[model samples]
Target: MSELVAAEDVLLFVNAAVTATGQREFRSSAEEQRFSLGFLHEYVRVNYRPVYAAALALDVNHHNAALIVEGLLRTAGEAGGAEEKRAEGRLIAARLAMLPPQRVYRLFRALRAAGVNNRRTRAIVRGWLAARPDPALDAVKYRTGVKAAVRHVHGRPADPETGDFLFAPGRRVRYGNALLDAYRRAHYEQSAVYELPFTVAEGFAAKHGVPRAVFLERIAPRMTRLERLRTERASGAGAELAVMPLTRLALYVLALPFGERVGRRAELTGALRASARRAAGPYAGSWGRVTAVLDDSFSSSGSAVKRRRPLAVALGCHFLLEALAAPGAYTALWTSGGDDPLMVRPYGPTPLGTRILDALETEPERLVIVSDGWDNAPPGLAGEVLRVWRSRLDPGRGTSVVHLNPVYDADGFDVRRLAASVPTAGMRDAEDLAALVEIAQFAEGRTGFTELRAYLDRRVEHFLTEAGA
Candidate 1:
């Protein structure tokens, strides 16, 4: 056989090992072991060398190496490689099964640190103890370790059973919190990439029993959403849901009566007002004046006035939840945002409006007011108001307004394409606002789908370049 093994070949071998189907024994001969290790080292260099190095440093055995590799993959590349993690757990179980009782304790310590405390995993550990039946001492030893770890102030439980440690009843562990803290640190710093994937996998797998490949194929997208939600929740974004000031324009228009067709007008107007009422509770007493505008429009007789209500009603629902949940956290309705055509709110005004006026006056040069050219206002009305609002923003405070246009919503009305045809500077439509918000986010250091595409583009180019090189 040729001495040189390609990176792809080494990857195939490693992949097989992870799935528990490869040659269990390393090459018996010294020369073959050398070639194998060399191939393994190169494979990791291109893929996960950093993780392998860390795990290998702790224990140079094949089992630990496999765990660390998959862990790093899940963390760095997969985000939630549940299937791979489950496979790794099984390998750990198998290794523990072969070891003596004392050796099994060490395995438990490592596995626990990785976040694998499931019953199936625990059973494997128990099997080792069964061989040496220390019934009287086993519970005591396990309980003591658990209590000490939990009481250490640093310990946080990896599992949901908070305040209770993994090994014993009443002996709580705080390892979970510590692990999360460590995860944040390592992920931000990129120093401990391997451990997190391993840790997260073990933690999730212990609870969910997801196989590694299935995790990649199935759970990753769902996990990404949950992860994003968790991030927003931790940041206090969820509780802060409130209406945007700009959206009040739509609410004002919705309350008015329009066209001669009086059939669904009353029903539509009622639905719009109810949504507004439900939203009013969040801002204390801020809802009173906004709702009055809607009620007065019904008493008016002008057809021109009534013509604006449909757009107003449609835009009113969009404005309330999103403006309150501004800068992000926008969804149509909690249930609807999760489904169909997939609605997501674009980013909104920068530095926030509550602080915008004061901040602009104090530190004028630092202020940036970003808006999408579109809001759900009638074209002429939306344009005039935005300009008037911009004037009030205090140019003397050194504030600069960036009015982004060509807003889009895969689901919204097309103000952007219309704007391209007309390029009018006046009031923008709902489509304009949607596109502007998306663009503003992209402009303001937040990565969007386009940014991700750009990243993938660069990576692809680099790969092709390296292959040619």
Candidate 2:
């Protein structure tokens, strides 16, 4: 393959790995997404193993990162060499540490189901379990997965009663651990249920015939941040937006009634801006003359599974870019011609092309388009506008244009791009916009694999340092 083709192949997998999570999208089924993603994983691992390993260090979502970890461990013997396997091993450990506890346990279940019983796999499982702050809680909270994982790896629980609770539930009359004792007592006592995590508490609450509202209120202290957000939304309590992620905050904003959004515009926008600043961190006020053409069209409503996800991503990117831009140098153009970002609902057809033209007239130094790239409000106008702007209007390429697509096109096996002239990257969250934009820039004529590798190397060092593994 040619150099450009090789680079393009890697970029294709990067985009797919970044965005496809085996979930339904605005135009694709979940099955198709899984099939396409699985195929890409195998193809990239076999053809570009190094890049595949390096991707774990990139801003890939936890879903794909876990998939990568499993794939590497499952096919351990196929690695290029000892050095490669060592590199992949470190990346796996670092990425595993970054994944949520539930996801890591789910991965263990998957490994057990797949019958991957290599010594290395056992070591990884043992190390992760050894690092747990409290294994007894895991046995109580995530009983099935933990039991299977421990048995599959032949692990011995630190607590003797915990063993009885998992392999032989009710075998022991009483337990020493408070959480385990609560689990045993919760079978009969509604008061004991409030001591457990919200999810585990729910089952006990149902068994004890406790009212949902009363249970939520009583278990408020034990609820996680996200659980509190959900319960508080229904209970008319103010959500703790100060601690929520930017994308999730946008989803919450979109879920609110229009009049409520209008009534609380200042509070909502302030929270978003504050969260965006945190995500931007040192990159704040870095991009100059930034313009974003955000798509909130009907298609951006996403799917039944991912309700208003694309719109949420766009909303997230808006505030993120605002924080990343030089003060007063950023402007947002909504495809639906909506000026109020707070009130942008999923309506009207995608007029991406019109938005592109309008953004271009503003003479921005950097143009970022957050769209699915259907661009059919006058089909192909966006591509033509880009073509003329790249070739005729500004042959020297004064303004940099990049498309950040949220949805993956399973039919194409990649994110649908607006034009060949402008580089495109798939983005899972607005928090990773800086990294994704840097990757997209490499796909343009400016840089290639060597630079990409250097970027990945830098990321790998930082990731491992942060992971301390």
Candidate 3:
């Protein structure tokens, strides 16, 4: 493939991997997402193998990262491939180190089921398990997964009790490991269940008919930050909402009853802005004369599974951009024309073309458009406006414009673009906005595939060092 075509192809796959989670979206079904993603995965793996392998370091979502690991191991494309097997192996190990334990275990199960028992695969699996700080606790909490992983890897557990707990349960009258002992006791005694991790205790709680409120209350001290944040809404206490990631916090704020949100506007909005400032970090107030055309249109309602995810991403970006702009140099225009971020909700057709026109009139030094790129208010108005502005109105390149799409359009094989002139990068969280802004230059046709590959190489090196892998 030509360098330009190759550059675009890698970008298309990167965008899909970053934003698509094989879940239902406002404008697409889950099956549609899967079929589209499957095709992209295979196509990139065969054509741009090295870059495809390099994506592991670029913060690809858990779903895609797991798939990448599986594909790499199944093919076992050692030394003779475009990227050496050793290098790819390091990427796989680093990515697995970053992935959730559940996903990594699931991936191991899949590899075993597929009959992929290569030496490298076994070593990778062994190394990951060796790195866990508390494998004994893992034996208790993730019993089935750890069991499968160990069985698939065909090794005895380091602790005899841990091995017996999986292969020969209740073989010992009392296990040496405290957590292992708790697992055996929780099977018979109600109070022993409380000693286990919250996730492990949940099943015992249900079996013993304990009320959810009581279980949650008792489990609060043992719960992780994210766990408490997740259950806080249901349990009615315990999470500092501000501690949540900006996108998640925005989604939570949007999920609250409108009346509750209005009544608690100061607290919620203040929390969002503070979180935004933290995410902005050293880059805070760095963008000069910035304007964000954020989409809060009805289509942004996302899907039931994703519930307001698109809108949440936009809301998060709005606050982050507000934090990133020079003092009094930022402006945000929601497509629905709402002035209050707190009051913004999904409604009306997406009038992106009009919003683009309005943003352009202000002549911002940087224009960041966060949208799904539907542009249906007047059919292609957004694209036309952008095309004209890029070619005619801003031929001298006076203003910088970049599109950050929160939704990936399956049929397009990429995040749908408002215009070829405005570089569009898929974004799942606004926290990634600053990094993606620099990454988007490759999509702007200013660089070729070689430079893009170089960029991925740098990311891989840094990712390995930072992960201390």
For TM-score, the strongest prediction is 2
TM-score of each: 0.20, 0.97, 0.97
Return the candidate ranking by lDDT, descending.
2, 3, 1
Q: Candidate 2 residues 1-469, lDDT tens each?
A: 3666767888898998888899999898999999999999999888888889989988888889999999999999999888998898888877887889899999999999899989889988888888888899889888987888899899888778888888887578888889998998898887899899889999889888988878887888898888888888655656788779999999999998999999989999999999999999999998989999999999999999899989999999999999998999999999999899999999988888888889999999999999988888888989998988898998898998999999999999999998888999999898889889988987775566677778778988998888893
In candidate 3, the residue pairs with backbone N, CA or C atoms under 3 Å apart (3 or more residues apart, or in different chains) clash, namely: none
Q: lDDT of each prediction vs. the true structure?
A: 0.33, 0.89, 0.89
Clashes of each: 23, 0, 0
lDDT of 1 at 329: 32
Question: Which candidate has the top score in lDDT?
Answer: 2
Per-residue lDDT of model 1, residues 1-469, tens digit only: 1212232232223222221111111112334333444454455544543333322222123443444433443343332366644543444444444334444454455555666544444554444444434332333234344433343323344344332324443444223444333433543443323234332443444344555444343323323333323333233332111222233334333333444114444444444345444553444232211110110112111124233322343355344423333243333321111221111122221222222223324432212222222333233443443344445544242333332221111122211211211121111233233322323332222234345344334533454344345
Between prediction 2 and prediction 3, the one with superior lDDT is 2
Error of 3 at 402 (Å): 0.7
- Write the residue-wise lDDT of candidate 3 on 66-180 in tens digits: 9988988888753355447888888898888888888888899999999998889889989999988898888877778898888888877887778888888857888878888
Off by over 4 Å in 3: 78-83
**Model 3's TM-score against the true structure:** 0.97
RMSD of candidates 1 onward, in order: 23.4, 1.4, 1.6
